[model samples]
Target chain A: MTEKKVYNVAIVGATGAVGQKIMKILEEKEFPINKLKLLSSINSAGKELVFNGKTIIVEEAKPESFEGIDIALFSAGGSVSKQLAPEAVKRGAVVVDNTSAYRMAENVPLVVPEVNNEDIQKHNGIIANPNCSTIQMVAGLKPIKDAYGLSRIIVSTYQAVSGAGVNAVNELENQSQQFLNNEELEANILPVKGDKKHYPIAFNALPQIDVFQDNGYTFEEMKMINETKKIMHDPELSVIATCVRLPFFTSHAESVYIEVDKEGVTVEDVWKELRNAEGIILEDDPSTQSYPTPLSAANKEEVFVGRVRKDLDNDKGFHLWIVSDNLLKGAAWNTVQIAQSLIKNNWLQG
Target chain B: MTEKKVYNVAIVGATGAVGQKIMKILEEKEFPINKLKLLSSINSAGKELVFNGKTIIVEEAKPESFEGIDIALFSAGGSVSKQLAPEAVKRGAVVVDNTSAYRMAENVPLVVPEVNNEDIQKHNGIIANPNCSTIQMVAGLKPIKDAYGLSRIIVSTYQAVSGAGVNAVNELENQSQQFLNNEELEANILPVKGDKKHYPIAFNALPQIDVFQDNGYTFEEMKMINETKKIMHDPELSVIATCVRLPFFTSHAESVYIEVDKEGVTVEDVWKELRNAEGIILEDDPSTQSYPTPLSAANKEEVFVGRVRKDLDNDKGFHLWIVSDNLLKGAAWNTVQIAQSLIKNNWLQG
Candidate 1:
């Protein structure tokens, strides 16, 4: 075996939901680390987080924070990622950003490990973790695309409030309490926190997930549309998305409809491919009532897929229900996986 | 008005969720009822329901209950409707069935008032109310179908627990309380009460709305498929549905994708048609963050539609978000509307 070189890892926004998960994942994964740094926004500085049985103090992230870092895992807001990703890269740290800032940049690779692990090698100092919804979808689609050259995809997402951040999760809890008590529910941080209007997500389904683009699709929907093409390396693939925020707290689920290029593909064919795919769990026997709800997929790392069936009207069309812990496989795990891929493939140096 | 005739009306399954809504709608519409009868299953026969300041005692429905009734609105289970609908018709009363018993019986007309109110005229005795999801979707699609002529429909529903009836609503309440307290959830009803498995609906989504058929689609899905074809009077229309049960108390929302037969049907063109469509509220203004969530559309009678956009890849493909009260427009209001149509068109005497 080759001599192991440990990484000096730093986590940006270490107090956020995805950030906390990253710390726990790095610990659970037993990744080799010479030193671990916890960095957060100014407001979240001075906080203490326990990692690997040691209490680490979170410091304010600044220009000099990335010094002596080998891999910086970022789950900070988009503005923070925009400001610090390049600075970290310039300091010789490879960034696996969990924000949308660098995802579509031509030089940055938007990746789902199962779908495009090779893309990680092509990253220029920084790599992007695709949207939570996009990561689960691309992971589920990778096997299908390899078996039957894809044509089109139409997806509807049932996303958890955790994707909006910890504040939205608290809002869902508070609003649900208010609703159960027959009191007036308050809405502050849901659907889109930065948008002008906020909607209650307790026992309600909001069709908008992110700020809407001028073309009428929300940014989350557009990310799914654009990022799927990039991750699959199929620029001509037809992708459309409708993303909705639900009351769930952890796992995000999607109802996907796809038209494959191959005509003779059956449900068994799709199931066989999905069962054999990396990082996918198939819980799909209809007679046994086997399927994955969001609650069932929570705290798990793999993408859970079920309810695979052929379209009644279109022979080439098939439907699948894909679910995953958005904070894990969708964000933190994918980021750390990229870091691991970099080290394993000896592609760490710029 | 043409010498108003007070008809004798009976409400079957009068203790049910939709049946109670039918009673309220009848009182609100001030339908000239000469006599009112409330009927339920033997288990709930002695319950009391109030209508127009009078407490009406619910009685067990038998074949003889329709002897003096002019119109009967049935929201009972399918077996009850299958047993008594023909009997009520034989006893000289027209039955507007809110069950799925005879929806595709070839002789019965599946009616959505805005889309196919004229179909009520051809009812020999029992006119079928379409499925809750189907009713809202077809009502939203009516004007577009008229303007552009639709060829195909693909819908994924976010249905409230109330669509499963009172027990499901109670289950949601119980499961929610259990979830909030961090206790083990005991789910006795949901996603098909009689199915082998019961999944908790609080903060979770069940992709199977009803029991799975041999083809892997749920009964609720097949209902949407068969009923849409029947209500549209088009046997050739391609339709597919994926029905899911959500945790909301009322209102069913759908993410609908349609292919219009006419070429170059823009979003503005579809919006123009939807603006004038009867019983439809056009709520699509993404710039203003105006859209209909389940909570916003809960108590309303009209079908609330928003998020209308043209698919980027398929010019003929248009996506719509459709929502309406499952108890009102979905079942009860549509049934009441058919009864009023029967009275208005002087087709009451079968």
Candidate 2:
């Protein structure tokens, strides 16, 4: 096993919905792939897909499809990751970028491989990923902001419609079968499919997700208040969000609140730091109504947290709920766990 | 105009869903009734119900069905509004109630005729009504808490499924056609059809909206934090709800946030006091993706303020969204505007 170095990946919106959930989570995490590719655009190339059990096809990406490509990922849109994520980091590839194109870029490391896997060795080769409602709300409040010390968050989300992709999940299944057949439901795409208005997410909610900013928030609420202070490095904390769009089709829930910074934090001290955190899943109890819902955290991939309490009057506030699976742990298992933490910490050359 | 005195109302859950939207908003606000009883329960009593064009008949709610009811209303469940709203207020009928039995009953007032219609002249005979997600979030934050003295109110909601009534709106339309025919959904009722589990709001998002209280919150998040501080008379304000239950069927959006104790204020000064308050309908602009959603404030009847903005780092916070029709202005147009402010302030002999 010491000789197992596999690599080559590539996905780039290969028939999206988070690029077919990053090719079914890289064939259910049997990822040490030596060559998988896929790519997309030009009308979803030829479209074949499959993965672990063979058949690839998808093609058309170009910039010489990242020559040999050692791990690309990218969920396709912010102008196709601002034109092929630096041409797949100038051919040696190492992208990860699931859209808001290089998430607040300053050397691109918005990551959430469970709250900053050491910001993946400070990635300069593009490792962004963060916003599927800020990747399950900072991966369910990064272990209650690393054992009580957060200062303020305030979220609200409840998102879904497959994070507005796959044609807003076929326009929420054709406006929920035209609102259960009473008809008239059609609305071109969603709260933000290239904005200029389009509502009716079937039963409805739409507080407008992406597209609005010039101060009034909603570029998915300033990408969950600037990718949660750039992945919790906490730029003077206090965030804000609000991003709605409900009529679900895959998890996103949220409701957050936070305030911590100690001073007797409780809810059993944020459930003992979300039961010793790590891709969290607490599912609070409220005496067995248990918790976590967006269809029981649909297609689960962790980060469920639940109705944690404490804030009848802010003894440093609390309130949680966070959920997940916005296409698996919000966007193809946090972009294949930051491409499996850049191939098991060998941090793939920037 | 001086001959306008008709009364004799009644309607206790006139066949549910906020008593059929309080009989289609008392037949579209032609409320000067004279005898429109239609009560229910005892297996939806005869169920005729047509209203303005006549038919009527629901009947069964006894204790002499509030005899010559000068104005009743109740809304059936909460042990039939704590047994026919005190026998329709010992036969004189000022009631109003729409359940959660006498909301926090300190001699009951809870009303939200645009946030405390002078607490309906200190009602001693039940006026209650407040939680259909706390009457459109304290009637869209009572004109930004009378222009900016609010303090705090978090909220979250997104509720609907007819605020959990017509069998949780037929279990969200038979679990959304058994999740659009992939089958196997069947949840009996919802986030709380008398709690103890039953998720699947078809497409999902039920952060338990009621039942679960011994301090973990949810009795619809402590009825939107003890009825928005007893209809904003402010018991040191600072509210905090989180109720959820989405996969809608008719309005109840929320998202709220607020903070306000004066200071600089401006999101156009909370949109010019939500464009001069009363029954608010601001629908914030955000360059035209305008706001207010839950299916564009479903059946309408007011409160639909929009994404008001302002909290970029808490300039006294802000961030609204609201929306109405959780059965018209959250439960039959604020219980027929507190029965038209207890019959145009004659106070209905409370």
Per-residue lDDT for B139 in model 2? 80
What lDDT score is found at residue B330 in candidate 1?
Answer: 93
- CAPRI-style grade of the A/B interface in model 2: acceptable
Each prediction's Cα lDDT score?
A: 0.92, 0.82
Q: Candidate 2's residue-wise lDDT over A180-267, tens digit each?
A: 8888988988877766878788888888777887888867788788778878887899888888888878888888888887887778
> Which segments of candidate 1 are over 4 A away from where they belong?
none
Give the Cα error of residue B2 in candidate 1, in Å: 6.3
How close to the true structure is residue B108 of candidate 1, measured as C-alpha lDDT? 89
- Compute the DockQ of candidate 2: 0.35
The alpha-carbon deviation from the true structure for residue A125 of candidate 2, after best TM-score superposition, in angstroms, is: 13
The residue pairs found clashing in candidate 1 are none
Candidate with maximal DockQ = 1
Model 1 per-residue lDDT tens digits across residues A1-350: 89778999999999988888899889999999989999998898999889999888999999799999999998888899999999999999999999999999999998887898888888889999999999999999889999997899999999999999889999999999899999988998988888898989998999999899999999999999999999998999999999999998999999999999999899999999999999999999999888899999999999999999999988999999999999999999999999899998988874
